[model samples]
Target: MKKILVITLAALLSVFFIDRSYSKHNQAVIQKTLINEIKEHRQEPIVTIDFRKLYDFKWDEVYVFTPGTSLKNIEQTLGFTWLDAKSTGIKNRDDMDLIVFVENNQVAQYIMLPRKYGTLQPMAQKGNFMVKTS
Candidate 1:
């Protein structure tokens, strides 16, 4: 009986880990696709964002990157390079607005942009827009 119970528990644990891994793999695929799309659309015009709703967050620093800014530079600008290189999707120059959220002096979810910015739809809506001038 004890042998059977141990086998059952091990099987359940393995299944749980497998499911978690698969879920994470699925998310990475989605993010990779999105990053590729951003790269493909590099020539596209900059997207606008309304800052009214954005001010709600207690961001330690907010930066507006214009055309021709590299992703690594952004990491440097934020004064931290601990996040994944792919976190920002693609290089800036798409008029990327980075809103940083800090907790206990540590960055919280540097991956927020890639996950929240699908089609950049949540932004580019009605409100005061910052026009980028070359």
Candidate 2:
């Protein structure tokens, strides 16, 4: 009976330790994934940025705008579009300034990942950062 209790206590302790370790390393692991994704998608120079660096800048949701898609399409994809862009003489899809959002200095998210530019995936399917027109 004593042996059974000892084994059960050990098992519970091990589980608790493992869970704690995972929680402690979660942020670092997330950062690594972001970096890898950016490296995979980054072309030539690899234009990368971090969220904390651009904390001064606010952003909207990450919107995917494919060819044949219009502003309305972007609005739908992003859930919000720059109403001012349309009114402020900022016309044309190419004319819109889209900034990629990164975390821990990695390109973790963006609006578009054109094959010509590069294919970028976020570390997490969803992150704390976002892309928007600057």
Q: Please tell me which predicted candidate would have the highest lDDT against the true structure.
A: 1
- Tens digits of lDDT, candidate 1, 16-96: 999767755754554454455455545555434444453343434334443355767766766766354345444533534
Superposed Cα RMSD, model 1: 9.5
Cα error, residue 122 of model 1, in Å, equals 3.5
Residue 14 displacement in candidate 2 (angstroms): 66
- Scored by lDDT, model 1 comes in at 0.48
Query: Which numbered prediction scores highest in TM-score against the true structure?
Result: 1
Give the residue spans of candidate 1 off by over 4 A.
46-112, 115-119, 123-134
List candidate 2 stretches off by more than 4 Å.
Answer: 1-44, 57-69, 80-82, 88-96, 100-134
Q: What's the count of clashing pairs in each model shown?
A: 0, 0
- Clash pairs detected, candidate 2: none
